[model samples]
Target chain A: MSEMLAHLSLGFGVALTLKNVALCFVGCLVGTLIGVLPGVGPVATIAMLLPITFGLDPVGALIMLAGIYYGAQYGGSTTAILVNIPGEATAVVTTLDGHQMAKQGRAGVALGTAAIGSFVAGCAATLIIAALGAPLTRLALLFGPAEYFSLMVMGLCFAVVLARGSILKAFCMIMLGLLLSTVGTDLETGQERMTFGFPPLSDGIDFAVLAMGVFGFAEVLRNLENPEARDVVKSKIGRLLPDWNDLKQSAAPCLRGTLIGGTLGILPGNGAVLGPFASYTLEKKIAKDPSRFGKGAIEGVAGPESANNAGAQTAFIPLLTLGIPPNAVMALMVGAMTIHGIIPGPQVMTKNPDLFWGMIASMWIGNLMLLIINLPLVGVWVKLLQVPYRLMFPAILIFCSIGIYSVNNQPVDVAFTALFGLFGYLLIKLGFEPAPMLLGFVLGKLMEEKLRQALIISRGSFMTFIERPISAGLLLVAVAILVIALLPSMSKKRDEVFTE
Target chain B: MSLNKIEAAQGWRVRSTQDLAAGLFMIALAGLALFLSRDLSTGTLRQIGPGMLPKAFAVICAGLGALLAFNSLRYNGEKLSGWSWRGVIFVLGAAVVFGLTIRGFEIGPLKVPQLGMLVSGPLVVIISGLAATDVKIKELLIFAAAMTIGCALLFKYALGLPIPLAPWLLGI
Candidate 1:
């Protein structure tokens, strides 16, 4: 305990530096701004900033990037509460009660609840990481290739349950994403798998390009196509803080969300993405008036926002300990760390105590910065709803194109992005959720790599999966989930829960 | 309201589109799987080969694609009409033009040479914006020029990314 305290103190010393603090501020501020912008997600923003992070000190770079990740989650809730546009997938739950609260002239209360709740969750998650980081890292290292693959399979299976739409369509999207991720050169044998001889195809598709093009640019096109959908809300930016009654309702949800987020955040997947969904579901299940959920329940905004932030912070644990990125953003974080010549793992804490502890300390500092930045800017964000879609779409398109091109100085990526954008928009039009596809794409790449390695090691023996207990358990769980998701009775139960 | 034929047609169209997409994806996955498995030497253990997992994934893709296709045929559902062709044409056409033009396109001797991030980034957006039914050409040109200049300054000068400025204009 004394040693941990000393390390934390050292961390604080490094984090409190003028340069580090300024970068954190910049990251958080930018995170909030972009998070407010509809259809522009944190992943794309992180990928775009990857090149820039190459120049910073490893610790400082990671600290700033980490701030941006959670800061965006905090920022996403503001738009969700104010205008009903969820800037990120995790923010979807925020829109349920958040938009309703806005209509009820309680936007201030909703926004305030989210801000405070997120801060609480962030603080708790930071503490949890400081206390449990070593142990969790140890457990994460036990995961082998088959285990990783099964974990990814489980994550993709969970997506089917998460998609608030047709299960069939969601599964299809997931499969499509996996297929798309398989594009480019096959890493193992150095053969082109899906690249039809286009030189750009040689590198395969960058998720950044796909995300920016499909979600960012396609959304702009979508909004422009339907002018009536653009200018839906223009409510007065009510009070800047939550009232006593609002706080009373939200406090419990924040606590619940934080606990749930902290536990799940330790998982070596996109545990952060699960936080909001699980929190919202838990809030509804525990609510006295469940019917009030979709219609501006303060608990909805508070719980999910908190969970989102907590999850975002906790995701760093795997990276900090085992060198595993739980998601694409974290993958970029790893790339950023590599650029700075700092290999992330268990040794990071021992070799660079200042950097590890400093990062953790900065996360806490960044959470406070979020409140300072987001609350006052809530009014400005509300004003953004009034911007003409015509102006906004063009700007969004331009930003996406520029961001994509900046990655590798490649025009082909931009063109590829355009292709995906069209494809994505088409999928949306057909009542398909794109979330599953994106998740599948990310998991598919890793799945291919791990599965190939496992097979190579085991001389193509399928029993290798069963030989590993942890991997076996994961696969069993995945199979069970697939079976459960397909059960007819579960669909009825799902409908009942969703409708309720 | 009872479902009309038009509504039903729309739904069928949506499902058919999805089916086609899924099918194409599956075919691609199968092709890749077949290729990946070609060189794999499966020994007596019959323990899944390196190509086995990929083959399984591909088969899953094919299976899912078939399911999607089957479902679409079984359910003659309707969906809302999607994006107008004009918008699609503008976005897609602009992209094609940008790709093709990167090799050679000149304006006032300031040639927009091949595959430069500096030139293509702004050009694609501006050209696409001008082509958009909702966008005004004059406004787009201004926006495009400003965006280009801003990008040039930001990426090229400030960030020191190796983005090539217009060939004739900057003599790079």
Candidate 2:
């Protein structure tokens, strides 16, 4: 405990520096501004701002990115409440009661509850990350090549099972992503696998280019097809702070939400996406009158919002400790870390202590800043929301063009991003979720390396995975998850859960 | 919906055109990957060469894709939606133009000079903005200008990223 305290205080020392604080503030502000826009989500907001972080120190860059993530989630809830459009899928639950509350002239209360609930949830999850980071890193250090490979397999399986839509399709996306990851020159042999004579393809595909293309440009293309729908609340936002009654109603649900969301987030896959939905269901089931759920129940907004925020924060645990990204957002984080030339894993904690701990400490400050800035700026955000998508999307396009162009100063990247943008649109229309693919892409190289190493160590015996206890355990879990997800009865249950 | 029914009446058992297309696409993708890696050696499991993982992943992907395709025939699934050609053309056209003009590309007789971000930025904004069916030209042009200036100040000046800001003019 004392060692942990010492580590945390050192983290505080690094994070509280004026420069880091300022960067965190700016990141949160920009993240919220972008995320408040109707179609932009946390992923797109982070992808757009990714290039800007290249100029900062590693610790500051990560801190800013973390701020952007949580801030985007907060902003997503705000959009859900006022505009009746969830900024992302996770915010879909928020829109159910949040928009209804706006219709009932309780938008301020709903927004307030979301903000406070998120702040409370964020603080708790930050502590969880800090407390768990060291021990998990210690445990991760014990993993061998076989174990690491199995762990990644488990992570991929978790992603497949947890993913929305057909599990078979999700598995296909993951394989495609792995295949795409193999396109560049081979690491050992220097043999080009699938570059097709393109020079840029030799270096493998750039992460930023792929992300900006799929999430940013493809998103603009998708949104352009849909008709503009801006039902911004025209009435005055009465009060920014929740009254005592609202607070009393929200307190327990918020606590419950944080606990559940934090737990789910620790899993290897993108379990965090399910956090808000699960919390909402729990709140509804246990409510004094379950009928109040869709009718702007304060608990409804409070629980789901808290769960969403907490889940976003705790999702960092796997990334920070084990170098495994549980979801696409964390996959983006891995890309960011790689750009800074810092390989993520236990080594990150030991070698770059300041970057690791500072990020954790900064998360708390980021949450506090969110609470400080958001309550007063609700009206300004609303005013920004009225800015039409016609205007907004063009700016997004120009910005992405510049951002992609800035990376490597290659015009080919811009063209490639355009190609991927179309590809992404096709993927979306084909009922394939791209999140698993992104995860697979990020982990592919590492997985391949580990598989080879393990195979070599065991002298071509595939039983190395089975002989190793940890590897065997992880593979067992992966198999169990895939089996459960494929079960006919269980498929119905999953569909029922997702219908919300 | 009516078109789907007609297709069904035509005695084609294909249920989801979307799935069928995706399956065919994946198979093609897998075939291409395999063809490309055919020259490389897939070394034994011990000291597995570069070709091994690529082949493994591609084969698995092809298998899953085939399953998806076969299942579509067995079960009713989503129908293919028409593509937004207007949005695709203008948006992608804007991006390609940005790429070409920001740093001009030349292929034989086609000679284009570097137009720089100053021109490319607004050009992209204006061009992509036209993707929307209800785009107001005058407002879009103005937004394009303002956005370009904002991006210049933000990317070039504030962030200090060496993005070409009117290279033809400022010679930076």
Candidate 3:
């Protein structure tokens, strides 16, 4: 405990620096602006801003990016409450009761509860990281090739379960992603497997290019498809503070959300996306009148909001400790760290304690900053929502084209992104979720490497995975999840959960 | 008579065209991948080579695709939505044009000179702007101009990127 304090104090010393604080503030501000805009998400925003961070020190860049992540979460709720549009997938559940509250002239209370709940969750999750981060890193260090491979398998299975719509469709998407990831020259042999003799593809597709296309450009296409679907609330702004009754009702849900989110966020493959949905379901089940959930229950807004923010923070744990990214945002972080010649993993805490601890400290400070920015700026955000999709989409297109072109000074990358944008749109049209594909893409190379390594070590025996206790346990869990998903009764329940 | 007529309906037996198309697409992609990677050596498990994983992924994708295609026949799903040709063509066209113009293109004996960041930036913005249903000519032109300048200043001057600002023909 003393050592932990010492480390935290050191972290504070680094994060409290004027330069770092300014970076964090700027990141949060920009993050909120983009987050408030429907169809613009952190994945694309971070990818666009990646080049800007090339100029900063690793610690400063990461701190700023982390600020943008959580800030976007806070800002997404603002849009959900005011415009009935979710700026990000994590904010989807927020729209249920949040929009209703806006209709009931309780927009101010909904926004306030979200901000306060997020702040509380952020602070709690930050402490959780500070306390458990090192131990988690130690645990990660014990994982071998087989264990790592099994863990990724489990992660992919979880992704399939959590995805909306048919499990088979999601599985197909994951397989496609894995195939895409296999493009480029093989590491073992000097042979190119799927590049089709293309020179640029010899090094593989860029993550930023894929993300910008799928999340940014494809989203623009989706929004443009149905112009009338987006409706901004024009009602008068109400009081911004929650009443004592509101606070009393929200306290327990907020705590429960934070706990649930903090635990799930540690899992790989975008586990954070599951937190808010799960929390909302839990809140509805436990409530005296469940029907009030979609009708603007305070608990609905409070629980999911807290879960979203807490999950955002704790999702960083895997990236920081194990050098493994649980989601697309963390994958981008891995790319950012790589640009600075720093490989994230167990060694980061020991080698660069300041960077690790400083980032954790900045998360808390960033949350405080978000709370300040979100409350007073709610009106400004609401006004920004009035910006029509027509103008908004063009700007997004220009930025995406420019950002992608800037990556390698190659126009081919931009062209590839455009192609992926169309592909993403097609997937969405087909009721296939893109999130699992992203997870598969990010983990593909590592999973392949680990699988090969484990196989080689075991002399071609597939039983190597089962021979190891940790690997065996993880595989069992994955198998169990698949079984449960396939069960007739469970499949019906899953459909209900997703449809709700 | 109503029951017999309802049961005899035989148009679009696959229930969801979207799912059927998605499944067929996946299957085709998997087949292509397998065919392309057939030449690569799939080393044994102890010495797994590049082709091994690709082949494995192709098999899995094919299997999943088949399952999805089968499922589409049994389950009712969402209908395929109308395509926005304007949005698709203009947005994708803008990107392709920017790519070709920024660096220029050459096909056999023909050559197109690079237009640099200034020309390409506005070219992209204006072309993509045409996709919008409520495009205002004056507003769009102004936005295009502003965006080009802003991009030049931010990317080239401020960020120190080496994007060219003008064509060699301009002698800038």
Candidate 4:
């Protein structure tokens, strides 16, 4: 404990440096702005800034990028509240009561609740990172390839339950995502799988291309299609702060969400996005007046917003401890770190204590900065919404194109972005959730590689997955979840819980 | 905003578009996966063929495509309809144009000789501008030219990416 405290003090010493603080501030501010914009998501922003980070120290660059990630989480709720648009997948739950509250003349309270809840969650998650990150890393390293494959299978099971539509639809989306991930070269044999003899595709699909196309460009398409459909319902901002009653009602949910999110955030794949959705669903189920949900409930906003931020902050655990990235944003951060010659692994803590501590410390400071910046700037952000879509969308288009192009400085990536955008928009229109698709896309490559490696290690023994304790446990959980979800009673409950 | 109104708003036209789009994409993906799965020559258990995992995934994708088509066909329920093909085309078209001009045309400020920034930059802007709801000639030209020049300066001079400035002038 004394050593941990000393290390934390050392971390503060580095994070408090003038240059690092400045970068952290810039990242948080820019992250907030980018998050507020519907199309300019955190992943794209980080990828766009990747080239720029090559010039900075790895620690400082990471601190800034980390700030941007959590800052985007904070800012995402602001849009979800003021307008009914969720800037990121995690913020989808925020829109349930956030925009509803705004329509009900409680925008201020919704914004305030979200801002405060997120701050608390961020702080809580940072503490978890400081306390548990090392131990978690040790445990995570115990997970072999077979274990990881099983864990991902379990994660998919959780995703199917949490996804908005039918379980079959979600399963279909996941399968589709996995297939897309297989499009690149096969790593074990250096053989091309689905490249179709296209040299550009031999390297595989880039995350930036997939994200920009699905989340950014597809969103633009959706907006343009229904310009009037989403007529900004006139909302008068009220109660610049959360009322006592609001805070009283939200405290318990906020704490619960923080804990849930922090734990899930450490899981690989898109568990960060799943945190808020799960929290919202949980909160609603436990609420006395469930009907108040989606009709302007403060618990709905506070719980999910807190969960979203906590998840965003704790998500750094995997990146810091293992070389594995839990999400795309962290993957880009890994790329940033790799470019700076700082290889991330379990040794990151011991080898570069300053970088580890400084990053953790910066998350606390960055959250503080977000709270200070976001609350006062709510009006300013709302004003941004007034900008005609005609003008704003073109800028979004330019950024998306430029960002995708820079991935390899190759035009082929840009083409993929367009193709994926069409694919994404079509999915959205078809009642298919792209979140599962994306999760599958991100996990697909890793799953394939790990499965192949496990086979290689075990010499084609299918029992290898069951032989490993961790793998066995994870597979058991996957089986349990599938069984529970398939049960008639549980399926009815799930339908009621989601569609309601 | 009422539940009935929301449900009424989503109709068959929107559902059909979604079905067709998702179905087509799935079919194409399924075809690709199946094509990739073939001709796998595995040597030994220790050294698994690269195509093995991908082929398995392809079969899974084909199964998913069939399932998606089946779902759409059986129960076309509670669809999120509101088709926006115009928006889709505009964004897609812009991305394609960006790729073609940069890679295929090799058109940039530095390579264009005397008319580099003046011509290539404006073209980039104009193409991006085409995605907007209304195409204003003056505003499009001004924004396009400015954006093109800015991008050229940022990418070419500042970052120093190896972007070709001219296609016709510097033929080796």
Candidate 5:
């Protein structure tokens, strides 16, 4: 515990530096702006802003990016409360009771509860990362290539379970992503796998380009298709603070949500997305009047908001400790870290303790900054949302184009983005979820590398994966998840869980 | 027979167009991948080559695609939604124009002049703005100008990105 404190104090010393604090503040501000804008998510925002981080130190860049992430989560809830539109997938559940509360002239209370819940949850998750991160890193260091491969398999299965709509479609998307990940020249051999004679294709496609194209450009296309559902901002935002009764009711739910969110966020394949949905289900199940969930229950606002923030914070664990990104946003972080020559993994903590601890420390400071920014500035965000989609989308397009072009100063990347945008749109039309595809893309390269290494070590014996205790346990879990998903009754229940 | 009765009679055999299209696309892509990587060395299992994973992925994709296609016939599913061609064309067109303008493109037989303009940002904004249902030219023009300046200041000056600010003719 003393050693932990010593490390934390060192982290505080680094994070509290004037430049780092300023960067954190700027990241939170920009994150909130991006989050407030309907259809603009942090994945795209981070990808767009990645170029700017090139000039800064790694710690500052990551601090700002992390700030943007949680800030966006907070900003997304505001839009959900004031207007019915959810700015991101995590905010979807917020729209249910959050919008209803706005209609009842309790928008301020809803917003306050969300901010407070998020702040508390963010702090709890940060501490959890600090305490458990060292131990997790130790555990991750023991993992061989076979264990890593098995863990990724388990992660992909969890992704399928959590995906919206058809499980078969999700599997296809994951397969497609893995295919796309193989587009460049083969790493082991100089042989070109699928580059089709293009010179630029020798290097694999940029993650930033792919993310911006799919999440940024395609999202605009989807939003533009349905133009009728414009922003309907509630005119009256009552008191910003919740009453004593409201606080009393929210306290337990907030704690429970943080626990649920933090645990799930440690899983692979963007399990953070599942946090809010799970919390909402839990809240509704435990509620005496379950029907009040969608009709303006304070518990609904408090629980899911806490869960979303906690999950957002804890999702960094796998990225920081294991050097594997659990989701697209973390994939962007890996891109950022690679640019700065700081490889993520167990070695990050020992090799660069200051960078590691500084980032963890900055998260807590960022959460505090969010509380201050979100409460007094609620009106500003609401006013920002009143901007029409027609005007907003063009700016997004220009930013995306510029961001992609600036990455390599080559127009070819931008063209690739445009092609991916169309592909993403078509996938949407065909009812395939793009999120799993992204996870698959990020993991595919690493999984392939690990599998080959393990195979080489084991001398062609496939039993190597099952022979290792950890790898066997993980593969067993993956098989269990698949078996459960394939069962007819369980599959029906799974569909109901997602659709509901 | 009425349309409703025909639909009822088809029942579980009725396939969703969306699923069918998606399934076929996946299968085609897998086939293309397999064909492309067929010549690459697949080496032994102990020392697997780059092509091994691609081939493995191709097989899995094909199997999943077939399964999805089969499942479509067994369950009722959503119909494919109408495509917004105007939005699709303009938005994608804007990105293409931005790419071409940023670094001039040239083909031997059919030639479009290389105008390596830095005004790609504003050009993209204006073109994509037309994708909206209601396009106010005056508002769009103002937005385009403001965005161009904002992007120039942010990317070029502040961030020191080497994006050009004007056309070659301007001689800035």
Candidate 6:
């Protein structure tokens, strides 16, 4: 315990320096500024801003980038609340109840709850990382390719269960996502399986391009089609602070969400993506009045927001302790670390204790800074809702264009994004949810790689999955969860008939 | 919003037109993928070929899509909606125009010099602005100019990204 304290105090010492604080503040400020924009998520925000940090030292650059990540997360939630558009898959859960709250003149409460929930979750998660991160790294390393494959399968099953639509349709979307991931060149064989002779596609589709087209551009088209639904929140913006009762209701869920998010975030291969979805599902399942969930439930906003921040924070453990990036944002951090000539591994802690602890300690300060930064700014964000979609959407378009183009100086990516936007609009028209597909797109490549590796390790023996205890356990859980989820929905549908 | 139109069928109408459309779309997509990957070898499990997953996933996608289509006939579900041509055309056209203008494109004999952000930025704001039914040229043009300038200063100057403000006029 004393050793941990000593390390933390050292971290604070480095992080508290005037120049570092200024960098952290700037990172958080700019991260929020750009993240609050519609369609731009944390990853995109970080990618776009990466070049700016090139001039700074490694530690200061990372601190600012970490601050930017947290800022973007908070800002992403703000956008979700006001506009009903989630910048990324994690924020999708936030939009469900957050936007509904906005439409009901409770936007301020939702925003407040999100900010508060995030702060609490962030603090708790940071502490967890500091305490458990080292030990957990050993467990994470124990995951063989088979274990990873099984874990991902379980995650997909959970996704299937949580999907509001038919299970078959969800499967279809997941499969489609997997198919899309196969479009690029094969990692091992150097074969372009699905690129159709396009030189640009040989590297596979960029995640940012797909996200911008689907979430940002397609949203504009959907909103343009329905002006009434577009400008929904004309009612009064309530108090900026959450009322006592609001806090009272959100307190427990905030903690529960943190726990759920933190656990999932620790898993490798971007497990953090599932945090909000899992928390939202748990909240709805346990809610006294489940029907109020998609409408404007405070718990929905509180739980998922907490879950998202916690998951995101814990996800940093793998990156800081080991070289593995848990998600795309962490992957960018890896890129940043590489450019700075710091290889991220266990050596990071032993070799550069100050840098490692400073980054983590800076995350603590960064979270506090976000709460301070976002509390007053929530009002400004709400006022943005009053701007007509006419002006707002054009701005979204320009920003999205710039954000996407800024990633790679390639114009073709923008054109491809436009095409995906059309594709997304079509998917909406057909009553298909895009969230599952996006999730599938993310997990697709990882799943295939793991499956291939597992098979190779087992030398084509399918039973290797069952032979391994961890893999077997995960697959068992996956099946059990699937069956359990199916039973409730079936019974519920039958009960509806009886009630009628 | 598109009209929830159920096309007239012979004896058995598609109860869930939305599902039917989705099923059809998925199947077509899968079939296209299969065709594209026809020549690729699906190697054995020991050393799986690149084609293994795609071909396998495409086949399953087709199967699931067929199931969705069949379910559409049995279960009552949502009808497919209509599309917004105006939003589709102008919004996407603006994005394409931004892409073409931001960096000059040369295709075969057709060559266009780079217009940079000064030209591309306002073009995007203005072209996309036209998607609105009540777009005002006066206000939109003003907004466009202001937005373009703000973006130029912010992206090129403040952030110091290598994006050119005006390449032909003033080389960066």
- The sequence of per-residue lDDT tens digits that candidate 6 reaches over residues A13-65 is 99999999989999998898878766567866776566567657899989998
Q: What is the lDDT of residue B8 in candidate 5?
A: 63
Best by TM-score: 2
Model 1: share of real contacts kept: 0.30
Q: Is candidate 2 or candidate 5 better by lDDT?
A: 2
Query: Could you tell me every candidate's TM-score relative to the true structure?
Result: 0.84, 0.97, 0.95, 0.84, 0.96, 0.81
Which residue segments of model 2 deviate by more than 4 Å? B1-12
- Which residue ranges in model 5 land beyond 4 Å of their true spot? B1-14, B109-118, B167-172
Error of 4 at B92 (Å): 2.3
Top-scoring candidate (lDDT): 2
What local distance difference test score does each model get? 0.70, 0.89, 0.85, 0.73, 0.86, 0.82
The local lDDT score (0 to 100) that residue A10 gets in candidate 3 is: 95
At residue A221, candidate 3 shows an lDDT of: 81
Question: lDDT per residue, candidate 2, A221-301, as tens digits?
Answer: 888877767888876677878889999999999999999898898999898988899999999999989998899899999
- For A1-500, candidate 5 gives per-residue lDDT tens digits of 77778888889999999999999998899888878887777777777677766667888888988888877778778888887877667888899998889889899899999999999999999899999889999999999999999998988888887787788888888888898898888888988888897888888877777888888888889989987475455558889999999999999999999999998898877789888889999999998899988999999999999999999899999999998888777887887788788988899999999999999999999999999888899888888888888889999898888888887888888889998999899999998878788878888888899999999999999999999999999999988988898788888887776665
Candidates in descending lDDT order: 2, 5, 3, 6, 4, 1
Locate the minimum summed-lDDT window of 10 residues in model 1 chain A. Answer: A224-233
Candidate 6 local lDDT, residue A29: 89
Of the two candidates 4 and 6, the one with more favorable lDDT, higher being better, is: 6
Task: In model 3, state the lDDT of residue B25.
Answer: 82
Candidate 1 vs candidate 3: which has greater TM-score?
Answer: 3
Worst 10 residues of 4 chain A by lDDT: A46-55
Per-residue C-alpha lDDT of model 4 across residues A1-500, encoded as one tens digit per residue: 77668877888899999999888888888777777765545665565555444346788888887878777777777777877777667877888888898999999899888989989998899888888866866776777888878877877676666676677778778888787787777776677767778888887887667777887778778767665434354868887688789889999999999988888887755577777878998999999999999899989988988899899888788677755666656666665676577877677887888898999999999988888887888888887767666656666676667656665677778778889888888787777877677767767777777887788899988799999988998889878877998887888887765553
